[model samples]
Target: MSVAKLVDRENQENGGKDWIVEEFLAFSDDNRFDCSDVLFPQPYFELSNAFVSQDNKVSLKHLHKFLKKWYKDLAGVPWHDTHKADGGYYRYWSFEAACSVILLEINDDKELYDYLYYPKDLIAFYHSFNPTAGEENLLNKYNRIAIKAGEKAPQSGYWFTVASNNSRQYFNAGEILPEIKKQDWGEVYWQFEKEE
Candidate 1:
């Protein structure tokens, strides 16, 4: 079954809560829905709209209670991304057999809810695209060069030059420009030129 349908079915089984149910769907909606790589007997999936309610708080408590009952050695996942818990979002994480479970809720209504499993094999995908400050510094220097070239030419294509080996290497800046704007070194690395 499709993940959305699976989620909707699970929601029905757990007593549906109000939200944009048909609007936004599962993260893997575009791909296959398999139980082997993820947690089975799927949990609740929601999108919190920041609607505050004592009932919602009770719901959050129940979700946590369920997780505690199921998993062991529960610990908070140290996330760097901006998540406003005080604004009414809560997060919980736990692990077993190199697979991790993440439970998240946003606002009192629990605007965004996700129960995701991070398998050991998938860690490389995240590592490939998470940027570092040192990489950002390097990009900044190259960005300046790219922007200067863009200003001078005012063309529709890459017109940048990198000084190297007493020579210049002309590279297409189109691919890397967006990563530069976002200051994302991981993307830059992913698209970096590979030696033949």
Candidate 2:
């Protein structure tokens, strides 16, 4: 009935070693990423985001494969690839970005949106979407907002798709983001107009 209870039941079924599900449970508790039982897609988003956020050390290829296996049918093929913002035009999304999309697409719940879009959380999630080293997109884009906010960037580049070497433009843009308040970064994050 409850997500925690459901997760506990899953843990029991897996002999307490279901790392993916366990990670999701841990994330849910840590981030307060909870939702009402009536919200079906919330569980899916929570589970996927938690799984993706668990380890930034994983290879981007593996991340793509995992997403494809679980999400391809509903979200489509592009959801399995790196986002256009990350220099790949395959319609992919980072874990947090995807969670943002899910909240909007699934229910448009502003409270949940604010929770997921908090600056600290956004920066962390952006970092978690790190790409593997030597991914040849030529023009890899890191989130300046994350770096400027004092969060650590992943050691490896956070990219998944390989674009043409000739058309690449490795520029460090997305800088000059809105200055958010310390206590209510989410409010600022929500109100800040994204410059495209």
Candidate 3:
């Protein structure tokens, strides 16, 4: 019924979070990755400004893959690959950037990579939709596109498709954002405008 319960079930069915770490670690059961104590390391979690988009859908599998790579690559050692801005759950783009990185690592989908990793091309298209010329030409190019955060959006905006609602650009962008305030952040996130 709830996401946490679902995650717990997924873990039980598959393996505990730490157990998942054990497999990727260089250390075996004898000298496993010092992953016994995890700090829920500061990540770009978007629990606050995270609106259940009609387009983007996250599942247990998504969480599994995201943390699997994040812990292995980030927590495996002392150094991590993230920023303080990413820690702000209320901040929009930070979370998206984090998600983009995670998805990049796990999925490595060429097209998705281009969309999330490189926002320059996407921005060009978005702007072009206004008749503003771009570096390339292809009318329906702006259709069915999603940009996480990087070069295009100053902060981190998302471009989504909603058959009837038309394309949407989320102003707040964070993948692993955590809440700064109470449950208010969730509702507050909607007040902001979806800039194009």
Candidate 4:
């Protein structure tokens, strides 16, 4: 089941506690998890949401509660990507996995680390499937390139270039630019082409 449905079902199973239910609704409606901003109102409420109650104090208490159940979900094989013969929505499992980690408690750093894919893996994954290299594809790759990262990531934003199969030379996601940065094997990075 989708995370939103699971959260809602659990809330129903627990009976209504006004505050708790309201908080869960608040999180479920939040823009952070809205994978498709285009689908407003109803669609936003049904998918891509999970309840961990990240607001203010007692977050860890809440995190512990979720960690208890998250393992069961994590242990299962991920919902892999699927393509439809007709022009329906394409499933991007790698991005979904990344989303799941970003919305978590970071309990076991190692386990959380395993949830996200490296830039190269994501690159190759998408590249293998792309049929038309168009504006949307560029935008998608641009968005992915920003979030795609290593396990022990340095900082938290987009870095346009990644070491493709080649050495010191890195490739931009859309072939529009060249990015060169100082990565001390596994530390400090600034931009497409900068060093410090």
TM-score of each model, in listed order: 0.22, 0.22, 0.17, 0.21
Model 4 lDDT on a 0 to 1 scale: 0.36
Instruction: Report the Cα lDDT for residue 94, model 2.
Output: 41
lDDT tens digits, residues 91-135, model 4? 433343323333442233233233223123543454356556686
lDDT values for all models: 0.33, 0.36, 0.34, 0.36
Once fitted onto the true fold, the runs of candidate 2 whose alpha carbons sit more than 4 angstroms away are: 10-17, 29-59, 71-196
Model 2 agreement with the true structure over 52-141: per-residue lDDT tens digits: 442433323333343444444334444444443566454323453344333323222223333322233444454456656655343343
Can you list the residue pairs that collide in candidate 2? 130-158, 131-157, 131-158, 131-159
Our model 4 lands, by Cα RMSD against the true structure, at: 18.3
Per-residue lDDT over 95-187 for candidate 3, one digit per residue giving the tens place of the 0 to 100 score: 333333333332332333322233334433433455435623444453323322222333444544322243344645444222124343231
Regions of candidate 1 where Cα sits further than 4 Å from its true position? 1-39, 42-55, 72-170, 173-189, 192-196
lDDT of 1: 0.33
- Candidate 1, residues 1-196, lDDT tens digits: the string is 3445446563445213323232233332434222212123223221122122335555455445444343332223344222544443343332321121122222332221233432323333433466689988777655432232222322234332332222222344343332223333222212122122
Specify the poorest-scoring 10-residue window by lDDT in model 4: 38-47
